[model samples]
Target: MTVKEGMGEEPERYRVEFASGTAASVAKRRSFRDLERNDIERDLPGWPAQPPFKVRGFFGKLGVHVLSATTGLLMLPLYILAEALGSPASPEKRGELEERENEIDDFPVMWAGEGETARTLPWQLDPSRRSWRTVTEIELAEQDGLVRIWSYEDTGRGSRHLSWGGGEKVPGSEAVLWSMPRSEITSAEIKRFSMAESDFTVSFRDGSWARLTSSPHGARRIVALLGQGVPEGCHPA
Candidate 1:
């Protein structure tokens, strides 16, 4: 099978061709260009058109909204009483809120080379730590014999505001946290810690190990790559 990607006047499109003369095409909305290009692999047929609207449907939605508002109002006094009792404390200071928001705005974007597949997964380096979780980004390309992985810092460099109200962009450095050839890996497995976060660990023939936490999708991708006998273990332990 072969895959091709390109940009055109319309949305970015990808074409996949199989040797048996079968083919599939995918086109993503322009607004979602920043999302992982390979996500088309999981695309499914769109849902059928909605049924005609009915007065009963409208009243059903209205009833739901009314019930939700009534419940919220009923809980308001209890919420206020809890706050008055100093159960949850007062509102956070503006500076503290800004600091937290800055931390979130700094997350990094991981890109892959042509013909390569990459994904970023939520990760927790130290579950015991009170700080927020981090992320692990990995890329693999069998044709290029490449397997690259990077760990982005939870807190990124300060935000950069874009002109014309384009919002802000956070710049993440291109630093490889860990990398190794596909052929070096002898075994790989997921390790679960009682207090610490679970992580995927690759054991090398040289007796070294590299560990990383990843989302379920990322873990599956890593397992598939390791199954291909990619070299592993860039760091000791």
Candidate 2:
């Protein structure tokens, strides 16, 4: 592969290695111009399509930011008031945040919500404190011989608008936050349920498990897709 240089800049070189243990789709560059194209590299046929993050290119993003900044300034006092008046994260939760910040900080980590139904919050909340009210993207990809689930912060910095838009762009800087290899994952199925959301467990080969909470519809769907994948850890103490 060759990189182009024209603006008195030195050419940079790089290499990407794929582990044969996993499935991958490879497309060779037809021309040096191929480098200019910014498209998703891995194209999984059966996987879900990416969510939309529309704003256009640089100017479009700039305009949105300017508008948001203007609006945000007006809303600043309300934001400050909300911070003062609204309930804050409990000391324990704050401690947990700091403790796990190193482990996971790009995307919001799981947590209970406010009020009586605290423990029953969605597996991923609408406006998460961890994500600073920004939407975090959950994605599945085949890598390192396993199909893995990944979360990208603020949807890969896709759409920065305040509300009503989302999607991830795998900005290279995006970190793989939460995921376990498919080989290690025994199953991901709902273990408990309520009217609003269902709590599911992701069992592993070692009989260890992680719990996930999702909407009722989403819960069954997730299990249907991943529950039967070499299921084994039925009893994880």
**Per-prediction TM-score:** 0.32, 0.34
TM-score of 1: 0.32
Q: Which candidate is the best by TM-score?
A: 2
Q: What shift in Å separates residue 218 of candidate 2 from its native position after superposition?
A: 3.3
Error of 1 at 1 (Å): 21
**Superposed model 1: Cα runs more than 4 Å off:** 1-135, 151-169, 192-198, 228-237
Q: Which lDDT tens digits does candidate 1 get at residues 1-237? A: 012222422211111000010001110000001133222221212312222212224555466567656967887787788888988533212111111111121111112222222212122222222122233355554544545554444343333221233222235733444445666556555433201222355545554333444544455456555663324322211
lDDT of 2 by residue, 54-172 (tens): 22356654665576568667877776776798843221111112212111211111211121111222222222123433333333333333433333444433332344445544366
TM-score of 2: 0.34
True lDDT of residue 47, candidate 2: 26
